[model samples]
Target: MGIITGVIGHWGWEVEDYLLDVWEAHRTPIILATSSILICVWLYLYFSEEREGLVALPRQYTVETKRTSPFQLSNPLPTTKPKVVGEKATTVGPKRIRGEIPRQTTQKESPKRDGLEIQVLVFYSSLTGKTEKAVKDLVEVSQEEINGAGTGTCRFPDAQILDLSEIDYDEYFINPPKREDGKAVDYFYLLLLPSYNIDTINDTFLEHLKETHNDFRIDSAPLSNLVGYSVFGFGDREGWPTEEDGYGFQAKEVDRWMAKLTGRKRAFPLGLGDLKMDGKARLLEWSSGLIDVLRMFAQTGVLGDGVRGSGDADESDGEYASDEEEDTETSIEGNEKPTKNKGSIDDVEDLGKMVAPSEKAPLAIDFTTYGKSKPVNIQTPQAKEMVPKTSPTYAALTKQGYSIIGSHSGVKICRWTKSALRGRGSCYKYSFYGINSHQCMESTPSLSCSNKCVFCWRHGTNPVGTIWRWQVDPPDLIFSGIKEAHYKKIKMMRGVPGVRAERFQEAMRIRHCALSLVGEPIFYPHINEFVGMLHAERISTFLVCNAQHPDQLAALKPITQLYVSIDAADKESLRRIDRPLHRDFWERFQRCLEILREKRFKQRTVFRLTLVKGFNIDEAVKGYADLVDKALPCFVEIKGVTYCGTSTSSSAGLTMANVPFYAEIQEFVEALNHELNSRGLEYGIAAEHAHSCCALLASARFKKNGKWHTRIDYDRFFDLWEERGPDGDWTPEDYMGEETPEWATWGNGGFDPRDTRVDRKGRKIEV
Candidate 1:
């Protein structure tokens, strides 16, 4: 250490002494220099970064001119503007202007909206093109109206249509994208989302919006800078069940979700376009209403309902919008049942408000409204081939011509219903079970059956499934829709000659509901609840099962009557007769029979044998008796299969020869009775309906002291059900033993050929 100090002293001549002397001599100058540098740095930071919230950088900028790519081109710089002495030259690239503010940095100052160039965003999802076309029609009609009116203030009408399927669900769910300019672009919005089937929202494109909104769910305040939106549903009311929310369920759900997300008021009421009716007219009407609403919003800076504040946040300057919306239900038959004293469709056009009190009744729909005379093009996809009841094509038909009761149930005017309406003849059911043919609402709770019967008249166009593939509609809506559709058919028959108004009115009351429509009725998840609903209305429910869903049958509530379709007596015949989906269909069939036997004492059980002569008639007496013993139903309806004009199903190959004659059906019934009697089971032929080629075999138990009690006393059964309620354990004995009405018994009232009817030889008048 001494040697190093000596070497330093030799070079600097006492360095420690020199440093001490210098500090004492220039201490003030050194301290002033340090203070000046610190002051200069603070001034630079305060001037550059203090005012705006944007990021700031130092005044001296670094420029990198090197290029990494070999293909980089070298270009001469453009001639620069002459600069005055001491003027700063601007460095251009992606840098922001120093002190300039953009015109659209906030919601209140959007230049596009202020310039009267209003645009709406329309998003839709549709398996069929009906919903998409409905949206387009609205936009097109709105544009034409805007141009025609020439209201310069709200002049330009531009709607940005987008498919929900095209959106990035994951990206939007994490963080909704915003405009690059940091402005809240104000615009009106519409959604035309249809439910995939009766009970689900799978196919609707708005599902992404739902997912994104749910991810960032907020309860305290509305979404930042969101605007009001309107909802439109495109669906067939008949396609959905009343017990379910029907076709409008999906649209309602979307509207509710959006309302919660934005905390914004609805621009207009929910615009519903029926899939089966005149959607173009409905779309046009909705668009016209929307224009009025938009005009009101533009002129007064408020909606007819209420006003929203101009600020970006949710807090409003005026009162929060009133929920004065009316509750209305639209059925397939253009039936609108208003649950409240609210405005009609015409009221909106006059008052420029969606909500108002009115006493106008629902107008009768003109068939001409569905004519091709209207220039408006409502695009519906035409199937290249015949559609099954389960196919999207058949589903689309509900939106076209077929009367859908609810999401799953459908009501079509049957051949028998038509015959009865024309005063020709009633259905075999009427003769067999006392069902009023004209007053019967023929529908199934489910369109998708588990078994695709070879003799199915639907041609397998409807959906089929081992389990329920659709959602269950609400019971209330299904009941209402069913009655509406049934009555609509009766109303159409009002113009026909010989149709009694009293009978038509009684038909409107809907005394009987036949769940024997094309599909399997038991597949509906809420079958029991639906039965209760029918009973509540004093309507008789005769639910027919395909004997595939034993569990569903077992859990079923007692209705007015229950019919199990015994298509075949043996397993092989069963497979050939009813193309079942289940591998263990035989076991399932046996189980269903066991359930029927168990439920026989609680409900009127009938084994419906559809006698296809050439198929299962060979050695079928003993086989049928065994099945009868297993079920032990109160009655058996042995009916000959009527040949409806055939198509794509196996039954299509059948000719008139396939349809057994009335005598053949009677022979089968007698043989079945003999087989049952031989086994000490008292089964005897009770009555016959010759016109329908059907016969009823009643249990000897139903005949007390030679008085027959085969027919159901529906009112008494309803009373018993009501007294017992859903959880009751009452038996059939509680309400049974009533003598069959003479008029309802098969032989007492048969189809009279004397009435003028449309037959193979055109109109025939019988004397």
Candidate 2:
């Protein structure tokens, strides 16, 4: 300022230093950032790149194909989806492996396993009383073999039929035939016979056929896949030559000892006949010509590549060969196309031949109503001279065609039932019921049954019959009353001959039915509302109670599927396979398994255990593990009881028909299913068909993350079945192929329904 004073005074102090340099150039950056003066030297350092973990790439892993049945799957499906690098050449036109493709493809079909599904059983056996009008015309030609035209089941997909007097066949070989929440059985169609004593054998059919000829592993390793058959012996002509229907000379010496135990070959027979008096019209024209040639050899397989099946016991059923075109004019210069095609009765001794009789035509009767130009209801010589003899439509039903009416053919006459086991002369195959329903859907219609199983099949006496026995007939009036009592039993059978008036009116026509027939039919308080009105018509029941009705199955109402029938593990083998009839039947059979575990439906709950070979196949694994611990059930089946009718008249009065003691009680129930999966608890023999039955199921897994696997939800058992709708809507997308239960990551991971990467006995290992 002094220098300024000197200057103007030197220019008035340069105008106050240019007005404080414009106020310190906007206040000197706020006092030089508040004191660049108070600060000095200092520096800090650090840096980063990481380039996303240095350029990644590489993954790969595979192997899939979990899909299951419904005609089996897989064309492209090995299961994968990261497929992003090459699909749009302007919309699906190019790329057969263009870019991100390492590629290798080959599996357009044939990993193999699925092509199996065909079925048909058709059995028949009657114990005189002229085989009850040929068991009402072979239950109307075995319900016209699942009907659809040309007795060959039209397109034939899964056929069936059975009725050796409503069989017990020792619990269908040991297992299959449960229900009531023990879920076992897997569809059927039987009418087979030869479970022995030929029906009236005596002493309860021979004490249930000497307990089924002293149990010889039921009869041959769970009946080795049962395959198809067509035997039809009934009796008389000194029962097929006597000493009890002279088993066609011991089945032609047990078919040369079963060709030394199955290396194949040997089958064909249709000779013997008679369930009583003219052999029920030659077994209804030989069951309408063996259900028209085993329903075309049970859906094609007339044994191709040069078809040649016929192992003669002396031929004579009309000398075999004729795939039919009005009984073949002898073609075979080239194979004529026409495709095709259960158990026991002491296993067919070289079986074969039985064709002739009702050869083809007639079989169609699925019945929603197929009166098909109706006619043959017949009987009127003045209405058969005015119906009488036991009046309820009689005069011995006036040579059939029964006219004394318009109503009342419901047929229920009753008595001759109370069995306790006694026959083993051999015949045994009976699984019919389907005329309208009753058995699993709670079969009351023929009145209530409370326990009278001396090794039952049906026709029990005492408590008397008849309850709802009507509205269900149509498979052609049970096949026009069994093709007019088997065309008056093929004019009294004898020397055979007669039948092909186009296969003897296809013995009228009927289809599958098997209410487990015999006693304790739940005890009929309208038995579970007639099993929900016979599963609303799709029909597939298999009921078999006898826990003396566990208070009528806890006052009825909860039976779409459930089965109790334990047959002894305590209370003295339940009185040797239910000889019960009250005394509080084992505290009402453990209170009907606590009312089948507090009832609920949608099918699934089973326990069946019949395994009676010499009274309880050696402690049947602590009697089926205390009936699967009071019914945690979903199946247990283990069946094996058979010796035949009245139980071969109750073991031919104890002289026992001898069958290697029912094959050592079916080889100790297959070591009680491997001692119930080595005591841990998992099972699955599921329908072996029979040597005396099996069927297990339930690995009961699915615990969640911690691990364990296959308690088999199998997409909920392939979308569950058998419902008539009481409530079981079933959803999981109805299963088949990969409909997504998805989450199956499992490859080398860990989850564990017991960690079974393979091992259903197929065994593998990775853990």
Per-prediction RMSD in angstroms?
26.3, 32.3
lDDT of each: 0.59, 0.36
lDDT of 2 by residue, 493-514 (tens): 2111211222223222211123
lDDT of 1 by residue, 1-767 (tens): 99998897787866777887999999999899999999999998865653443223334422333211111112113132222223333333442211211111012222233434345678787767777787777677677654443244444356678777776644332223454786434445677787655333343434654654555333212332333466766667676643134656677666655554444345554555566775566666656656655665455443322212221111111222323321111122222221222342211011112212352223222122111223222123431122234544343444333576555777755556655654566766665556767788777767666676766755444556564434456777877787776655554443232332234445656788888876788876677888888888888888888897777788887787789999999999998878777777888899889999888877788998998867877679889999999889988988888654343333335556778877677677777888899998987777667767777889877877776676666777787778878558876656564666554454553444323334432344342
Please report the candidate that would top lDDT against the real structure.
1
Candidate 2 C-alpha error for residue 343, in Å: 27
Q: Give TM-scores for every candidate, taking all chains together and pairing residue i with residue i.
A: 0.48, 0.21
**Against the correct fold, how does model 1 do in TM-score?**
0.48
Clashes of each: 27, 180
**For model 1, what is the C-alpha lDDT against the true structure?**
0.59
